[model samples]
Target: MFGRTKEPPAAAQPAEPSAAQPGQGKGRPTPTRAEREAANRRPLVPTDRRAASASSKEALRAERRRVQQGRINGEEKYLALRDRGPVKRFVRDVVDSRRNLGEYFLPFVLVLLLVQLAVSSSGNNVLFLASYALLYVGLIAVVVDSLLLRRKVRRLVAAKFGDEALFRTGVVGYAVMRALQLRRSRIPKPQVTRGQKVA
Candidate 1:
């Protein structure tokens, strides 16, 4: 007891371990604010700008193709605003079920142009007048056909759906546009054959 005085109260307790034991945490000190911010930072520009651009373009092209195919398949979800809804679908069926003079307008005009050119080359005043007369007649016929189509579509839609169906914007124009397009060139391809009755 004299040689080694009684152990002091402070030294009597065992010292606690200062460092973390293995597997006790990340085994590193907590990161400072600057260290965290630097670790999280990203470059403003892509490393491969050309590749990124090409990839984005390819993605957009693929999406367009998907939408186009969906439209051709007559999927309502993929259809454009102008082509959506059962009302529009009924209108498409009505137009597709019959032949419209408007679809022939382009071909008729082409023939008229050829006739006009031939007449001009031959300096035939009678033929020139005839071609002009024919063009006017064709334009009038197309207009008449479009008006009839609008009437028929409105009547059919109102009969099947309701008068309120006529209130939708651009319904007549949509039908007319579809009728004007060549049969083979129509989008959301026609579900019914020509002369097929539309229900």
Candidate 2:
């Protein structure tokens, strides 16, 4: 026949894509919602509650110790909230650089008390009058000294930091407290010493 021969049949082809071979995945069914929820669930309280509490307390104690040591070493970062600031620091230095009469007030008062008690027991009217006069004089001196210190500190703070520093809450009280404390008992122990000028 003059017509061309018919074409051969095409090779057979798969109707759908082949399945995945071995080792292709986790090889397990996906977890259901309930299974996932159960897996994630936890007890409201820890299994070892006492141990947990003890550990927490120990950690808190360690933190407090660290802060205490840091403060003793005069580390600014660990200072008490009220004592941490340049204004407070400057005021502290000012107070430390001078000897305030208020610093001796406690000891002076204790002495007067002892003297008065002794005099009262002896029934000495003259000595009793002297003690009262001395107590009044000492009180007056301390008040005068404290007033002078407050004025000086305010002036210095305003000069160094700015006038705005004068308005800082509790700054004046902070200086006065520091001035009243025995030098040895002051916290963040005085950086500047007596007669040592603070710039």
lDDT of 2 by residue, 15-101 (tens): 897787988899689999999999999989999999989999999999999988788767899998888888888888899999899
Model 2 lDDT on a 0 to 1 scale: 0.89
How many collisions per candidate?
0, 0
TM-score of 1: 0.72
All models, RMSD in angstroms:
6.8, 6.2
**Backbone clash total, candidate 2:** 0
Q: Pairs clashing in candidate 1?
A: none
lDDT of 1 by residue, 82-176 (tens): 89899999999999999999999999999999999999999999999999999999999999999999999988988998888888656788999
- C-alpha lDDT values of all predictions: 0.92, 0.89
**Candidate 1 Cα outliers beyond 4 Å, as residue runs:** 1-50
Q: Which stretches of candidate 2 lie above 4 Å from their native place?
A: 1-55
